[model samples]
Target: MNYISAEQLTKSYGVKFLFKDISFNINEGDKIALVAKNGSGKSTLLKIILGREIADGGEVIVNKDIQVVLFDQEISFDGEDSIEEFMMKLDSAPINALRNYHQSLYSTDTKFIEEALAEMEIYKAWDLENEMKQILSQLKINDLSVKMGMLSGGQIKRVALAKLLTETRAEHRHTLLIMDEPTNHLDVEMVEWLENYLSKEKITLLLVTHDRYFLDSVCDIIWELEDQKLYVHNGSYATYLENKMIREENLSATIDKANNLYRKELEWMRRQPKARTTKSKSRIEAFYETEKVAKTNTSKESLELNFEMKRLGKKILELRDISKKYGNTIILDDFSYQFQRGEKVGIIGKNGVGKSTLLNIIQGLENYDKGEIETGETIRFGYFSQKGLQYKEDERVIDFIREISDNFPLANGKTISASQFLRLFLFDDQTQYSLISKLSGGEKRRLHLMYVLYQNPNFLIFDEPTNDLDLPTLTILENFLAQFQGTVAIVSHDRYFMDRIVSHVLAFEGNGKVKDFTGNFSEYRQYKSQQEKAGISETEKIAEEKPQTQKSKKRLSYKEQRELEQIDKRLPEKEAQRQIVMEQLNNETDYEKITLLSEKLEALTSEIEMMEIRWLELQAVLED
Candidate 1:
């Protein structure tokens, strides 16, 4: 049953309609990901659903007993409240119990103290405290007792999440947790932990996020908000993308057929002689109607971007025995890597793992200690920082672009004007003169991107370029990056962007090591998984390898030893059965055969899960 439904939803901001006539449904246990670019009404729609904001015109129907928890990116807590205090306030029972307990401490009368104790017993306040503490401990927020006002944005976000996790109503049916960019300020480890938690939980989640890895791991359905409509696909983000492409292809084919028919009709009309007869007039009218219908079905003209670069020297940049130290912390220790021209690379790590630091060092924006940094003489670099475009508060948008374009001349041997550049970036006359301070986050980012491309550098480095971009812009950028000829190095949490653009991945592992793999994000994940299976230490991999230490021995403890033996014992049997089921599923066309194969696969999966859990237990014991 649909837990929430929006019919003919229309939202407008001033003269612009953010979205119109949009309709979709969210059911219980559904994990939906709303993906769109900035200013695409994703947040607005969420607000509408939550009744925080009213749509211009629409009927929103929410099922009875459905509780929603919305985590807005702009959420802020007031001053002087500790994390514990805030959590208690989210659920009044805990707060009331705490209040009574405090009151009892001050009370001299035994009757009042006894009553307070009875109240605490009834509310189970001790259990709530224990659960809250456990949650804090799991989130690594135990030592953080600072007031909410004192916490960093990332820390506050964590505290908010912890409160939500602890304060959930036990009796609430069909709860929907809505999160907007929840991963934005989270560290890599925190994101992974959240993904694991969400995957294990049996709750409905509707999240709008740019974090592709999080989406891929957590979301089973993708709700793409594009062209003022919501498109639902039942699968992971990657599968959704594949299916969307197929749909677009089909649309293209339909348009092509219509165009072909229209052309044939035009040819037929041209071949016939003009007559004053009634039959000829009727035929002409019918042709005009068909032509109008064909025109309506035609595809819009999309921008064609091509990034073709000249061949560069073999070594674009190289780092040898590089170690970067900030205060007493060592971020990169004796890290060595080489970037070759025409190579597309992605840099990934948990937040604060020095991904940005490495990018800055490569861009020559910062210096590193104890390392030799080398770059090809002919290398022209383009850098897009994670902070995106930084402009003075009072700076005008036109002035910003003109300043960047001052060095470059237009095609007619004239100085490139700000208006011309703005048009290229999709900002028209009205927006050109607007204050940079007033521009949306996405607009500012787009301006920076326009500047980067206008520079026409050979080597490009982007740090989370997709952070605030809307879905349409992201699609355009993806296509542009795919065809870009220069060497590109990117640091992004968007796995889809990384998979589509990068050819290799350089993952930063904290404590002075970076793992280098010669493939995209998916391939790098596979490599990491293999490394984990082989028991390769990331720290050891980062350090310079000696001839003797290169071929490291794999040491297994007693527990691991037993588990490995069991896995070996079970593999052949499972593999034989798995192969037989796969063959049957592949050959079977009937529904019943397919259903039976699916059931067999499900059973096999259950067995695999059990084995994996047992193996993990053994590994944990071995590590201990």
Candidate 2:
């Protein structure tokens, strides 16, 4: 069944056309990804389809029978409302019933609770409510009572995501889910989980994201919006790329032929006398058409970075047993690493796990409690943050860029004006003159990146720099960083970006622990999976390999030996309990009981895995 069909859609901003006379169809179970350069109307197209925005010309028809859920890039809410209250505001029958039922559990009003309970039964929202709780839990939204204003942008985005997913799953069979930049604020783990969830579920989806890895894994169809047109590819991202290259190459060859014919036609026209003949007039018209095709650009242009980096001394930056804490939470503990002259390290972990804290400490922006930091005398630092570019709404893009420098110096000692530099980053003359508030999210991100690179710092620190960037800009940035001759450190959730730029990975496990691997993100993930299969964590394996200070290796204590024996004895019992709960879950017809049994089974399985890992740790200690 076709959920949506768009015909001859035309949209433009100001005098610039975003897409013109574009037609596309979204059918049932079509996992489509919309990709384009920044400011190319990807989000605008989605808005038009959803009726949030009007198209200049053309029509969009959506099946009224199917439920539609949108996870927008921008989230808005009443600041005073709590998370639960915010969820209740959604005009979804099942969701409103579920939210009211949940809110009633914290109330002392018996009559109100009874009414809410009756409504819940009418909607059969018990299973949905349970699923909602699980979704919130996995997204780390623990405090449903927190005021909307108290949450950070990332937190708000997560809540919006939870709400969208819960609604989608509630109407999973008949839902058409549309999301824009859904992975922007998500961590690597969360992105991976979401990728798996979307790929495994039978939900129709259309989303715009710069996360190529997620797109490759979750989407079976790719839509490329370029030059006021839409090109559809019926395959994964990799397949789309391959086909796109072939298309570009064929276009290039065709253009070359056109150019050759245009030269001949031009010579013939020039050789003809100033006499007006019907045959010559017809030939002249044909020549003009040939010239048009000859002048057509074969592919999108990408800028190459050849900027000279500042000299780095041998010492570089180093942290000696650095430790930091905020109240009871330890952000970093006894962390020590020396930066080499030219090294790129990617930092990844769960949200609020000290990845940003580490970057701040390295730059001396944040102080550490128990360690010393050293930096080379000649080093210069450039920091790009997740907080993004802060500028007055009325400030022009060119003015903001000019604040850095009127002239940007290249590697060959040549200087280009600030306007030229902005153009290199794809900001046209009109766009550069426009106010900052007029730019798209991706456009703003590109400007921010241009600001960072203009400084020409020898040491670069980027925190979630890929949040609102489009794929083409990401590719350019990745290529620039990969060729950079400076020391680099990044904290990002973009797996494809990390894989392309970084040479090492730092896995920040919570509680102030970090595991370093000398490989790219993909390699690190593979190594981590292997370690987990061997009953060891990445941190444990790294710790075991560290140089020993004492002549004798440490042995398991008496208490540890007893604990190991206890784990061995408890494992079988927990496994048996898990089996019993699983069987009950399969046989239970009661929705409430099934939810309870599933939770019990999950907990039991986690306990058993913990015991087994403990057994392995204990055995390793004894062997040492």
Candidate 3:
């Protein structure tokens, strides 16, 4: 059954239509992703559905007994209220009323009190309390129970989410939960916990997020709001993308065929050599009619983003033992790193871990204490600050781009046309005239990206570039970054974006120590896990094992001795062979030669492995 339905829904702010003629039906057990550029009315549409905002023109039909919960980005907590009190506030009126009635009856009649108590027990208030405790514990928010009202924004969001989840579970309600940018303030572990919970729960969800991993893991459908319309694509975000491309290709072919027919009609009309009669004029009109239909069928072309940076010397940028201090707080300490030419590095850390500060220092926008920084002669850096161009509220979009373009030389040695350049970034026609203040967050981000790309810098630094972008635009940005030839450094909390664009990860844990991983975010996580396992203290392991070091030594004696001798003899040969293979692998472009060398290396490795196995067997025999 359709739980909620919207038909002919239209909304606008002044003369601009946020979205119009949107119609879709959401059923039970549906997990839908509401995706659009930031400020493209995603929040407004949610409000309209909740009846908090009146739609300009639409019919919203909701099923009876349907309950909706919305998690907005701006969270407000009552300072004087306790966490328990807040949870109670989220409870349905009937639940509260029933509890009150039961308490009153408990003083009146013995039988009534017994029955009321039974009802309360069946309602599972005890289980709700326990579940709340468990959730708070998992989120590490239990410690903030007493200070919930005074907690940071991120902490408050977690508290709100906990209350929301508790209320829905307590009521045993089939509810539709709307979340807007819920992952914005969540840590990776918290996000994983949320995803796991949502995946197991039985609730209809409509979420707006830039977190691609969350979308792929949680949503079964994607409702893409673009160009004043809603495009419903079934399946995960990845599947939606694949299907969208197929649809675009089909549309392109149909448009091409239509254009050919229209051209043929025009050619025939020109060959008439006389003023067109009514029939000929009608045929020309028919051609235009066909063209109109074709136009409607055509998909909008994506912006052609060609990012070419001038070649820089081998040493693009280097930071030697960099450190930064703010007041008494140390943001970065002894962080040494280097970015080589063509290296795509991603910077990740918890909020306020100096990811942005490091980027600023690299870009020469900020000064750092106790560090040596170097840049290549041909290296040019472009910085996309977190605020982007959104901070300039009064500026027009075209004027902003025009001002930035003044520093760059055009193709003909003339000033670059602001309108033309902005159009390449998907600000076409009337959109060029839109005020920066009026533009959506995603639009402002795109404008900023265009500005950075126009610089033709060899080194690009983006701070949370995917924050408010739509899914399509995010894909476009991902493609551009993947194809970019220059060194790129990005500070993003979006794991999906990081994984797609970066080949290396620079994680800034607190205390100024940075860890560099050779692969993307996912790979970095795996590497971190391995390091954690390897760091397990011997004392802890001993506590779980037989006490004496003598027993351990005796158990390992023979194998340890044999392996020690084997390693002593084999190490030099293995090292020599490994070095030779590495050198050849570096220069050998021929796949067949590389494959042969890899096989030979594998055989050498197996011989060392066999020696270790034999040594282990000898150790076991000696112990016996």
Candidate 4:
């Protein structure tokens, strides 16, 4: 059943066209990822379909039986309300008894609390509050007393997510969720949790996100917005890439034919007399139309970086015995590493494990508690932070570019005008005079990036560079970075971007522990998993090697011990099965088969974990 169907939809921003005559249907149980470049009306389409924005032509028809939840770009909270109050306000269909019960937990109002629990049991919402708390804990939101308005952007996003994913809804009908950049402020763990929830939940989702790993894992169908039209591709993100390649290939061949036809028509027109005959005039007009289309239909040009990069010396930045602490919390302890010349490093950690702090220390803006730092003779640095550029509201785009530099002096001694550089980043003649405030979030990020990279620094530092960027822009940025001659140290949670860009990683485990991983995120995750299994297996073998005590009376009988040993054997088999299922998940193209296998894998994983606990219990008993 189709949850939402958009037919012949058209939209425009004054003289700038967004998409026209676009048609698509979103079915129930469909996890569709809408991907497009910045300012390409991906969000506009969602708004129109959700009835928040009006379309220029045609309409979006949503099924009357379904409910829609939108996790919009901007999250709002009411005045002077606690976290629970704000959550309950958004969850409008709240159970009165449950609400009172939650409030009662922090108070001594015992007269009514017990009665509310009884009422909750009547509705079988006995576990509802506990479930909500568990979700909050997973999201790292522990302080319930904090006001909604006082929370940071990331925290507010998390609270909003908790409301959608964990809060109770009215019974009966299913809900269709539409989100815009839902993974914007999320760390990798949070994104993984959301991915599992969305993929396993019995809800339909339409979301726009730049996290390629999240998109590939959660979405089964991809809707690509390009050249003012929607192209729908089935299967995973990998499949989408395959389809896009095929489409571009076919389009390239068609354009070649058009170009051939265009050249022949040009010759005929040049040779023909300047006659006002209908046949001659008609052919001339047709020739112009074909030429216009052939030009418009051609693929976008790649970004070229002619960086005037500073020369790097052999002694690159190095740190020995670096330590930092904030009050009672230790962020980094006894950390030491020597950054090599032309090294591409990825910095990864949870929300507050000093990723940005480390960058600040490197730039000499923040002092470490204990550290000996050394830098090369020549290492000019440019840092692109997630704290987005602060532009004057009235400042024009070209003026801002000119502020950075009037013209770029390439490393090879070539000069390009500031306006020409703007054109390279997709700002055109008309947009040169446009106010900074007019740019989309992603466009603003791109402009900020231009400001950072055009400075000709040999060392580049990027903090959460993927935040508001669309995937296409990210691809361009990746291409630009690939050609860059500088050393880069990036702090980003984007697994795909990290894997593509970096050669090594600084993995921040919690509690002032850091692991130096010599590979990308995916490779490191796999390596860590295998190491953990091996460690556990080795520990078990050493226990078996130990001699039995002389006075030992078996606390656990021989049969129970045998059962536990058998469990160890079965655990590895189940783990192997899990790996096989995961490999199938990565390779499988059929949706139904993928769904069934995913469910089976989830169940099998849960059972294995439970059995491992049982095995531990039996081991403890025997040892005692």
Quick one: best lDDT, which candidate? Answer: 2
lDDT of 3 by residue, 476-582 (tens): 67776776778999988788888888978888766766766555787677655554666744345336443333454555665465344435434434544555566
Task: Go through the candidates in order and give the C-alpha RMSD of each one to the true structure.
Answer: 10.7, 11.1, 9.4, 11.1
Q: How accurate locally is residue 50 in candidate 1, as Cα lDDT from 0 to 100? A: 94
Q: Alpha-carbon error at 420 in model 1, in Å? A: 10
Better of 2 and 3 by lDDT: 2
Clashing pairs in 1: 36-471, 37-470, 37-471, 38-470
User: Which is superior by lDDT, 1 or 2?
Assistant: 2
Cα deviation at 299, candidate 1, in Å, is 4.7
Residue ranges of candidate 1 with Cα displaced over 4 Å: 94-140, 169-174, 246-304, 308-315, 391-439, 522-624
* Whole-model Cα lDDT of every candidate shown, in order: 0.74, 0.84, 0.74, 0.80
lDDT score for candidate 2 against the true structure? 0.84
Residue lDDT tens for model 1, 168-280: 63323568889877776665557777889888788788988777778888999998876677888888877888987887788777767767888988998998875647887
Misplaced by over 4 Å in model 4 are: 91-94, 103-119, 167-171, 270-285, 297-299, 536-624
**Which tens-of-lDDT digit does each residue in 109-197 have in candidate 2?**
99989989998888778877777778888888888999999999889999999888877766635888998899988898889888998
Instruction: List candidate 3 stretches off by more than 4 Å.
Output: 10-21, 37-41, 54-58, 78-88, 93-123, 137-142, 145-152, 267-285, 294-315, 323-333, 360-371, 375-380, 388-393, 406-416, 509-512, 530-624
1 or 4, greater by lDDT: 4
Off by over 4 Å in 2: 99-122, 271-275, 392-395, 415-417, 537-547, 551-624
State model 1's lDDT. Answer: 0.74
TM-score of each: 0.71, 0.83, 0.74, 0.82
The TM-score of candidate 1 is 0.71
